[model samples]
Target: MRRVVFLVQPQVYLLDLAGPAEVFHTARDFGLPYELSYVADEPEIITAELLPVRCATTWPALGANDIIIVPGKQCATLEDVNPSERALSMLRAHHRQGGMVVSVCAATEALGRAGLLDGRRCATHHQLQDELAARYPAAEVVRDVLYTVDGNLATSAGIASGIDLTLHLIATWHGPTTAGRIARALVVYARRNGSDEQVSALLRHRSHLSDLVHRLQDVIDERYTEPLRLAELSRKFGCSERTITRRFRDATGLTPLRYQQALRLERAEHLIASGTTVEAAARAVGFSDSRTLRALRAAGRTAAAVAS
Candidate 1:
């Protein structure tokens, strides 16, 4: 699970390559096992960014825990791909060996051409949704989505969605606590669970900056499990309650109390996902009772339903 092999191609989009790669790389910062390697059909490939990416020309053998990522290029059509038979064979072989195959943007073409998408549900950027279906009639080209997982194959939409999909994979493998730590460092606060609503609290209201708010956030990050009061926070930071509430809302779009609740809820979720009971997770995360957590989860469901 430590090794991640990226298959680079000429004219590949730099964001498409870096978005996912950086996710795994950032996970390493949180002490996750991640070793990255780059490979290509040639010694080097120029990106759409006008940058050169050099990689190993020879494909290495991969194991079940390893993953292969094929990022999309600047292709308007499938013919835009310079199909390397050896690269395709390596992809097919790795997949057959039970390794994960991840494709971003138009790189779904790689999976389709390798016969990996046949009758398998996959996804890509919104623009190429129709083209993927038209070209690979047997493949289910899901659209208007962040990512789709069909068994061992994971496909994602364009650009930023690559990071979202990679985070999902990391969460699945290592639990949400590890993923949440990485997302927080990346300044990504929220993620959609491929639900009907493609937004979440972690993603809302986050495009402003305030030192006061940041200081408060750092304190909350360290003491989310403790009972935190607005008056105490305001006094501790030498700010009035009005200024604290206003600035916090302006920066993060959540009240201080709600922000703390979100943090607790996220940790509670990770514990629950790791097989802790709802009751146990609630207690572990400093929830007074499981009923409160259930109410929060139910409210979240209602919010998503309304948003959708």
Candidate 2:
């Protein structure tokens, strides 16, 4: 069985680590042959969000694993958990021998600190974007997307984006049919393309902007599955149609309809990955009909397969 060794550290966010653990372990839930284990610099009890989790091996004691996953923590201080020279050297040695390293959220900082990100494009928690940029000038800090995969190195933005990254990894390794099954078991959107930005106007439209825009985004996100219209949405917000349209577009970079289309496509991708029929996914995302959805789905499938 292939082994994925999760390198846990103090202050590791439980979700960032656990999400992939569950995804990889439950591959049996979809009939894959792989195993996941937790390791660290020492056999330590780790805490995240004040929760406790245990590790079984120290980093140096770890053997050749198929993959190593490093997750993020809440610590804003880089100096605290940045990889030590020893850890950095070990990671470089593993990658030099063709091992895969997966870093989620701010854990990419450790990779950057090790000089592994110097010429690569990577993502992290949006809050730490500037710090990563200043710290690793040779690293191409990709601020736009949810995740990035350059060669054997894969990185993702904070929290939930990690799930998307893992799903993408599974999709790449096990084929879309298997990946969709795992995603369905997880009750998550199956596949947010690595190219998808974590802070797209659509995502930010729902949360990261001014209070009013944020509220509007919340409504759109919740009701995106239902039929939505500019006039109705404008009236609900107590604003004119034009004002709502302008503001929505400004906040999310896509008009309300286009934004909904993107959301539906995102959701459709999830459904399709979960083994749903393309027609069903299209209707679920509120497509006017199935033809366009099929066409779009075909185009996307072609693109992803080619990318792989």
Candidate 1 lDDT, tens digit per residue, 1-308?
A: 46999999999999899988989999887788888999987898999989999999877768888999999899877779765888898889989988899999889999988989998999988888888899999998887888998889999987878888898888778755566567777887666564344433344444456778877877776688899988899889998999999889888878989988887887787678769999999998788899999998889789968977
Error of 1 at 202 (Å): 4.2
Give one clash count per candidate, in the order shown.
2, 6
Question: What's the lDDT for candidate 2?
Answer: 0.74
Q: Model 2, range 209-255, lDDT digits (tens) per residue?
A: 55666667667666777888888888888999898878877866767
TM-score of each: 0.80, 0.63
Worst 10 residues of 1 by lDDT: 195-204
Which residue pairs clash within candidate 1? 189-202, 190-202
Cα-based lDDT for every prediction: 0.83, 0.74
